[model samples]
Target: MEMQPATDSRLELWHELMQFYIREAWLLDERRFREWLDLFTDDVFYFMPRRLNIHRSEPERELSPVGDLAIFEDDKTYLTMRVERLETGMAWGEDPPSRTRHLVGNLVAEPQPGGEVKAKTAFILYRSHHETEENVFAGYRDDVLRPTAGEWKIARRTIVLDSNVILAKNLSVFF
Candidate 1:
């Protein structure tokens, strides 16, 4: 089989996608969840798997993907639930609604089959409380983007964190 190469147009499209994701990061940092939701496909699969860190000498243990413990495994339904929780005064995690900032960079994109593009992005999430200083969580995201209705929307997203242990008090803010 002949090897396929990414076309110039594909590369340009990938750069446009990176710019789009950067805009998304800004939206999240601004706490614009509704507008952020607009960037997703109707059948989006957004998930964040738990990070695991074993000793260097210990044998690596096998685990499933986002099927295992995940920070957020969301489809459109789950996303709606999250929004509802944020709106309802019942989601104790965000009772006060902590302040948060999301910084995204180091984007890499690769062309996939079926006009889909697989991209990875590095992110740093800083959160703060009324009395406390700021807390930061750094991670990366592996995402698949597909063109739908003449626009690119996230199809699947898998977030991999650098730290296995979470020190942040609550996962209230969207990561």
Candidate 2:
């Protein structure tokens, strides 16, 4: 589908929104979960769908639907649980403690109907550990952002991973 041209006002708003996302990325890379949570709205939907391998002729929808293969589909409550688990040492994945760095760029923000903006950004996530050394997960995040209470909050996020196969023991990092 063709993108709708952004108006001058909308373009300005989109620029601010992109900066907001960059800050959020910084917080996450710094392991600032509480601060990261602050950026989300009460009804935010943060999610990552599992990328899978299928025949080249197969339609993407038949292979991986947004609702079906999600590594995460979280609201504020669930996000809180995840954070709590990480904090209390119950999350085994973090027991060994993997360090991660997320590099996000190639942001494209376009205005949508109903005071919403649709944005897509390319990301290359580098994750390292004392045990396994290093691995990378590269993808594009498709987001639906809306301005609320003087801040931009993600209403929805869909992560499309570049690789069909995953090598990490588990996805503990928020990409």
Candidate 3:
């Protein structure tokens, strides 16, 4: 099915959504975990499902968020706990705090029912930890955003990474 072109008013909304994503990336890169957590709704569903390389003929044996293992399948509470852990400065994976840059682009947003927006975008993350080669991760994200009290909030996000096997020692950073 094809999506209808956004109306003039909707175009303004799209711009706001794009800005929201840019701010989100900035927050993550700055390690502003508390503020980043605020961007999500109370019932947010954030997940990164495992991607598998299957033969072209066996397309059905591909990505799985349920049957296969996932790097993260966190709800708002789980995400809050992660933020708390990071704040404690005890999460070894982030104690030293890796330098990261998040580049987000190719955004497409469509207005959905219930005053929500469905958006898709591509992201490239560059991370450099203390004495290690830079780790690069590229992926696409699908998100459902809800407008609450005149502000946009993420209701759900599904990250689909480009790599079938991640080379990073730990996937601690938010995508």
TM-score of each candidate structure, all chains considered together: 0.84, 0.85, 0.93
- The total number of steric clashes, by the backbone 3 Å criterion, in model 1 comes to 0
What lDDT score is found at residue 166 in candidate 2?
A: 78
Clash list (residue pairs), candidate 2 = none
Alpha-carbon error at 161 in model 2, in Å? 1.3
Steric clash count of candidate 3? 0
Instruction: Give the alpha carbon lDDT tens digit for every residue of 1-175 in model 2.
Output: 3545778876787578768878988888888888887776788888877676766687564336656857778888988887778888777777667787888877778777887888888898898887767889888888888888877887888787877667777778886
lDDT (tens digit, per residue) of candidate 3 on 1-175: 2555778886787688889999999999989989999999999999898889988997766778564677788999999998999888788988898899999998888888788888999999999987876799999999999998888899999999999989898887888
**Candidate 2 regions off by >4 Å?**
1-11
Q: Which ten residues in a row are the worst by lDDT in model 1?
A: 58-67
> How much lDDT does candidate 2 score?
0.78
- The lDDT-based order of candidates, best leading, equals 3, 2, 1
Residue 103 accuracy (lDDT) in model 2: 80
Highest lDDT model number: 3
Per-residue accuracy of model 1 over 1-175 as CA lDDT, tens digit each = 1233678886687579878987897887777788888877889888877666766675344223655777778898888788777777787777677787788877778778798888888999888876775688898888888889888888888876677678876676776
